[model samples]
Target chain A: MTSDTALSVVFGDKISDEINDRVNSLADSLKKSGIKGITELCPSYCSLTISYEPDIISVNRLKRKINGILRKEMSVRSEDSVLWEIPVCYGGKYGEDLDDTAKLLGITPQELIKRHSQTVYKIYMLGFLPGFAYLGGMDSSIAAPRLSSPRKRIPAGSVGIGGQQTGIYPMSSPGGWRLIGTTPVDVYNLKREEPILYSAGDYLRFIPVSEEEFESIKLQIESGTYTYKSDEAVRK
Target chain B: MIEILRAGPLMTIQDGGRKGFADKGVSQSGVLDNRSMNIVNILLGNRKDEAVIEMTMAGGDFEFQNETFFALGGADMGAQLNGAECRLYTVYRADKGDKLTMGYAQKGCHGYIGFSGGIDVPVVMGSKSTNIRCGFGGFEGRKLAAGDVVSTGAPVSGITDNSYSPETENTDEIRVLLCAQNYMFTQKGIDDFLSCEYAVSANYDRMGCRLEGTAVEAVNGMDIISDAIAFGAIQISSDGMPIVMLADRQTIGGYAKIGAVISTDIPAFVQHKPGEKIHFRAVTLKEAHKLYRKEQKFLRKLSEKCQKGR
Candidate 1:
């Protein structure tokens, strides 16, 4: 955002772990710096656009403060990243596009599920709709084109593939993603203080479940007795 | 309290909007016309961030449940009270059982209704703005519907004689600061962008406004690493048309943007309805900041005058 709003700061140009780390580190530093007038910060793949109160702090002075922070040796903060195991039911009514997507990708329904559930994805960033995490590391074999026309309401927890990427729709939204499964968990529970389930730097692995199991999990969640299964993991 | 007798197509509770939640992908969904929202708020002597009812195109009927002071602003929607004419941009009293009705807007796209205090609604994620897409915040995380009842807080101050009439501009030209993947556009395309006229398409909302105009050729291609989006960013899609991102814009996007509309002009810019003509002008970062500071000063002075009864 440097040449743009005089409020945004771009760390790099492309998507790489090194660049993203720098972007995240800079955002963390800004948050802890107690730099007054900083209102909001949107961290993207390789850039950070900060929204601040113009009346409280001038752009020139804010730029000076950022420059001062950049000079310091920064570290990527990911020690506390959690590894969440998400359960999904991968066929029938839960996944409307499963049969069509498997046919388009030249794979059997079982094979599609196997490939999708095997990969542990890294939550690169949270964006689009609330709790919608843009995950990396989708298998090329499972890739499929998006719908020609987006549906008006894709239900929350529908796992879908769009091009070479895949993600979960934490809430109902109009989208073109090809749905392959449905998760029983409410990844974005508005009733809770923090609506979003996973933050950037967290890792999540999908576990295929039977439709019966999905119903059981759904019931448990409704009863508020389902505990989120997660494990401690070191940043690689 | 006020009961909505007829809720229009798009009526939502909005304030100054939330901050510091961009990391969770929440959009800054606030009032589209801040200038008018401020005008009504000032006339009623409410906090600048007080929540108000934002109506699009047509303002539906509202029945007063109690006696209170209220003001109207933004595009005049031909407001009437109890079958009589009701003025806009002025604070007026409404008695119990009074019904306020507004026909379609004759001037601007959005119309704002402000109370003496502010709409009493629980603030979620730090703001009262309704994020309709994400489905949270504001009044029950949704738009106001017919039969919906809303309450207002105690009046912070009394109404005054001070009034505001915005200095109208004849031209529809909007200034943009070219940055963030702007280099992808060719010099000739940039020239065409500055000189060309665009028509606002019917497909418009709080999310964005699409324009029908000359294609802005992107020599480096339209694809870019997804990056954070500003409120007024003009993203040139693969088809070459520019979409002006607005209050309900996504946190980040991958499309290449020519530039962002300066902050001061967003209110005036959003007032242009569908099929309206639009022009572009280039400005430096310094120039945009200077203009922003001037608007800030004007608002501050107006707020002080409204409070001091000057």
Candidate 2:
């Protein structure tokens, strides 16, 4: 369904691997088409919003162009997607709300961490803030609701959970999610050619680490010696 | 170099804005009233995308260390160059050590000041516009303040005495094109939205302009899958108040958008002050496109005239 000016191509009503892959494939083709007047192509969980200039191309003409591209049936390129293993320290000062969140879920802090790190999550989209990835795939048993009152400042690299979704805070900002852990890696560094570490459709696996390991990794990152591992194989 | 003596509220350097970054969740932060910004740049024969200082309701005081040609546009902010009254949409030469001061806006909310050679700021993500929320782009990724000196690019020739004054229209009527989610609103809701008069709420800013009026409730709920937001998206909050998203709005929003105000009319809409009554009128997409093309034609002719005045 498209707006009068912007075109929003929705794949399905639910969030599924098939839908995400289709969305990614469609986005890739539209980008490869090199359509003129397209200012931005914002891809979310199940839809892609194409913001274009009406002066350069009328909305009806652009829609027809997009429809023609869709009819060509592009396949998702697995090479474009990457799988990352992020290290996290899930307790103590780094995760201020871990114990409270675990108690609310009727589970021990260790159990909560185990459940969170065990699942391979998918990066549904990046929104709310710059480089903040909206992640999917979390154990329903450990689902936690957001805080009634949001914090004034949640530190950067904080892994949090709100409702059924789990994500990492790329930058320090006010948030209502319950913080469960912190990552030493800089997921959003503006100095890099690609500011965001991950893109939509990328897979993420959290690996539990100790506070001492977190500090050591933080030092390694500051020294520019830390490098993240990426696997080309896409997990089903 | 121009040094800020008194940086007024919410002053920032802006250009055409950082495009192609919305996919990464970056807002396209730029001048609120782009028409005014373009006119100021055109008057000085500066590049269309040259960065200019966007002043809000209250303007500021600055001292130039060198001679440079400058132009002012948009709101009548009572600008004075070296203690002499300066007019909007007119080019003026400022001598070394000249002090330029401006008072509160007399009519509209935004005012623009353009230098002969755009304001020199490092382009981040391909834009000089400031996104204060993300703290990147524009002068150090923030608003201008006291004691800050800003550089200017090399001046271009062919600066003319060309002046443009946009024809003032009825500010109360804002034209909108129905969006994809128009079916979500009941007929009564749609009628109420078009018929009722809305006042600009006090809680308006570069991000969005909130309007206080009769609730335009959706037949269905207001929640929807998050989608990209355009410059003039009219999103209805859960409370049913309409918020016209602007340049500094987030790249995407979850609220159901009823429609979008046409691009050509956005300049006049932004100039409106809080507590001012505004009404909406529906226009077909074709009509909206025609208005946009007409404005582009006028701007092209104006640019040509300025170039010929060398």
Candidate 3:
């Protein structure tokens, strides 16, 4: 709809090229206003969420203040890339739904894996759970919808694709995403000084590692000695 | 310490609630009637955020295993200590082995029982609240049942005072802030939402209350992406019936939230039992903010009066 409706709603309308101009600028404007009551400022794919003290600024007033900031033009940066190579083991016990997804797309499991790792995905948002990144730019050939009924529990670091989105389960919790592989990355570690392994806007590449390497990385991650490698590779 | 002889429906142990763990998918599950719970805690002179017992529908019988002070608030559940009318909003001293009992609620659904010190349940995820969803926090992460023994951390410094005051049971109406998704419905749907009296369905619990009301039309192919949801958020299900989520609401939801009840009006809703008919009215955000501040001021003054009068 219009910016009027988007200004008031907490979950604004989906991101579009038209609103992209406004979305790109709102971040800088918020910082410039010197607004004081907020505890956190988290920007996502299209919307920005500001958590404020209820005693200071009422919810309604906060909405109005944010709308004022939206009017300003923000500096847009196009060239930004931080490649993260995540080690994944595809089509095994960790990915129980791999065969089903491959059958749905009329392709072999190995072919599905090839297509999945072929494209570099963009971290669109991080909202479901802590460190659970919603990656965009998936290969549409392997695109699939989420499970009709969500599984009771999906293990942490279980990589799954739902519709055009692909993400790793940050924690062992109930989810409906279609699992294709398991990552050795500790996406969220509560005990660690810096919990979230990957922040939003980072590019990710899946490097298919063997089961033995997966186990070795898991122990290293658990023992607090896992050193992630970030090698650059141009799109081929 | 007190021993539960008989507990009513959905009695649970509660405290300040689990916070700062939302990233872990755990919701803050504290007392539903936070204001009343705070009042009872103030009367007992315990830590305002200390764990207490929250009973629903009807209260139960208990025996004071130790000589200590306790208080009751929230619902007008006629309570008795040694068969005598036990007044609320004031601390009462019960001797060791003294039997105390409570009758069916006359006004509200949930009530609070606060001891001088506090219920000393092991904390889980930085709270003593009993989250039934994940079976975490409070008395081994479960509901209070018959023959359950609830102990306190330490006795609070308070004496029995006849100067206790009670709350005026108010069920006028619930105030709400219209949500953004409200426009998804038609004008008639909005009118029906504010005018039609909804009955609290029997399917009520700490998670949410499924309401039975006028059947509104659910727009065809209307899909809502998962978003953050708070307590007292009225989410319209696919069937167009309203469901008011409570303290144990999920962190995020995919349903269309028509409106969120004003924060201060939560206690009023919590006091309502199943089958109770209540009407909702939309108020300007300005009015909501003013009312919230006014309520806070009134509570502070009332509490001060209670302390001085005692």
Candidate 4:
């Protein structure tokens, strides 16, 4: 029990696929249990923090329910992960640090994009801003250092690399992550019924597109004709 | 409709905030001072958690389109109705075209003004509170500007003032509870964090405020796998400086948080302006919950009284 309204259930201290799987599974189980007054069930790297309404359900009763759920064995789920094939334009004005990042890694821009787009990254959580997805799993060679001075504003849909994790900016915000590409898809949209396009426990594969294709997609989005390309990913 | 004659530095309509969207990376953006927000609503006999204009630092002037009863809560801004003295925590009846002018906040940083009915803003993601970072909700997902006309719902027939005066004196002391990653820091680091006084840095905003003072050394380093950030959580960055996470804080973060300020005292903690000093004291959860319940009971009683008066 950390605070009065919220409680943190820690699986482990380190970040790993096993720990994240457990965290997500527990979150789904709790949501399915039809528990009343559970406001937010936030699943992060290795823990799930639950914020509940104290007036609806007392703190002691909420603790007992959580403990009861914890007594059950955690199941690793892999079938429901949605694989979003994102269209990205790499190595240009959209990604200012592409050349510098490749130079630091002693690899060509072609090589960097090859390894980056090849792997299927899993989304462990969403945070830092509206609709910001924390996509885990990246090529070890693609890791880069944070900028000394964070940019005042990074445009939305900018794909950046930070340490071993890579993610899209979701919205324009001040950030220090090294930008390597930009996606044409609107990951976070206010007009849409569901403001956030993606969700945690999903997967993403970056598909590099030409400048012309990026413009076409943007026009399609504006004309209200574009639909996100995604399918349920079968876990490897 | 209320036409804004003069827009101050920052003004927005905030309610109880969006609650269920945190898992999707949406932070709860709401009024910083709920004590004041609720008191204003209760005073107006409006629904609890109704959207109200949150005027920060400097206040603004507006003209009512029709007759309505409005009340001022939270910080005192030397409000005047049609160029006459107006008091906080008291309901005032305004005629059509009556101009309400509010000056700079005399004591605290924010002021809440509640009309008979709540403001007429489309409910987005279960809240009318403005998520300024995301640029949605509130008035066009931005702060109100001069000449902008804002609508209000049908005013309740009459006003009910319980005549409750709230004690809102600013204090430098903030009570906290040790939790989360407090064990990550050294004993000396923890002692320094408690004993030393920290000044509120200028990097203060709706998201969080960075405190400039003695750095709390982390025994296992300051980095942690990003986890859900709570309002009033005191996070220690790599440099060891503490940043108090607030209402508009990101849903999750990677910094190691040593403790969280008690929920009840958050209204008082946010009053300190930049350069003002703040001291931290650790208290038991029992003590924290007692104060929280006390405030909740007070608000509940007001709502009940308002219902009966109506």
Best by the TM-score measure:
2
Tens-digit lDDT track of model 3 for A144-192: 9899999998988899988887878877779888998999898776456
lDDT of 3 by residue, B1-310 (tens): 7899988777899986676454334566999888888778766766667888898888889998888788888786899999899876767888888988987888788878888878887776678999775565798778999899998756655335623565565564888877767777777877888999898889888888888989655555235755556667888888888888788876556677778777778888877788888889888766766777776687676557656744
iRMS of every model, one decimal?
2.1, 2.0, 6.1, 1.5
In the order shown, the candidates' DockQ scores are 0.55, 0.57, 0.15, 0.63
lDDT (C-alpha) at residue A25 in model 1: 75
Worst 10 residues of 2 chain A by lDDT: A1-10
Q: How far off is residue B308 in model 1, in Å?
A: 1.8
For model 1, what share of native contacts is present? 0.64
Candidate 1 Cα lDDT to native: 0.85
Candidate 4's residue-wise lDDT over A169-212, tens digit each? 98899999999999999998877898898777888899999999
Q: Any idea how many clashes model 3 has?
A: 1
lDDT of each: 0.85, 0.86, 0.73, 0.86
Share of true Cα-Cα contacts across chains kept by each model = 0.64, 0.47, 0.03, 0.68
- Give lDDT for model 4: 0.86
Ten contiguous residues with the weakest lDDT in model 4 chain A:
A72-81
TM-score of each: 0.93, 0.96, 0.79, 0.93
Kindly list the per-residue Cα lDDT of model 2 for residues B1-310, writing each as its tens digit.
8899999897999998788877777788999888888888888888776799999888999998898888898888999998899988888888789999999999899999999988998888888999898888899989999999999766667684777776767877999888877787888888999999999999899999999999997988898878778889899899899999999998878898899888888888999889888999999878887888888888888899888898
Query: In what order do the candidates fall by DockQ, top score first?
Result: 4, 2, 1, 3
Off by over 4 Å in 1: A2-6, A96-111, A147-152, A210-213, B160-162
lDDT of 2: 0.86
- Model 1: clashing residue pairs? none
lDDT: worst 10-residue window of model 1 chain B: B155-164
lDDT of 1 by residue, B1-310 (tens): 9999999889999998777778888788998878788778878888776899999988999999988788888888999989888777877788899999998989989999999878999888789999987778888889999999999877655464656776768649888888757789999888988899999899899989999999998897898888778888989989999999988988889898888888777887888999999899989877887887887798788888787883
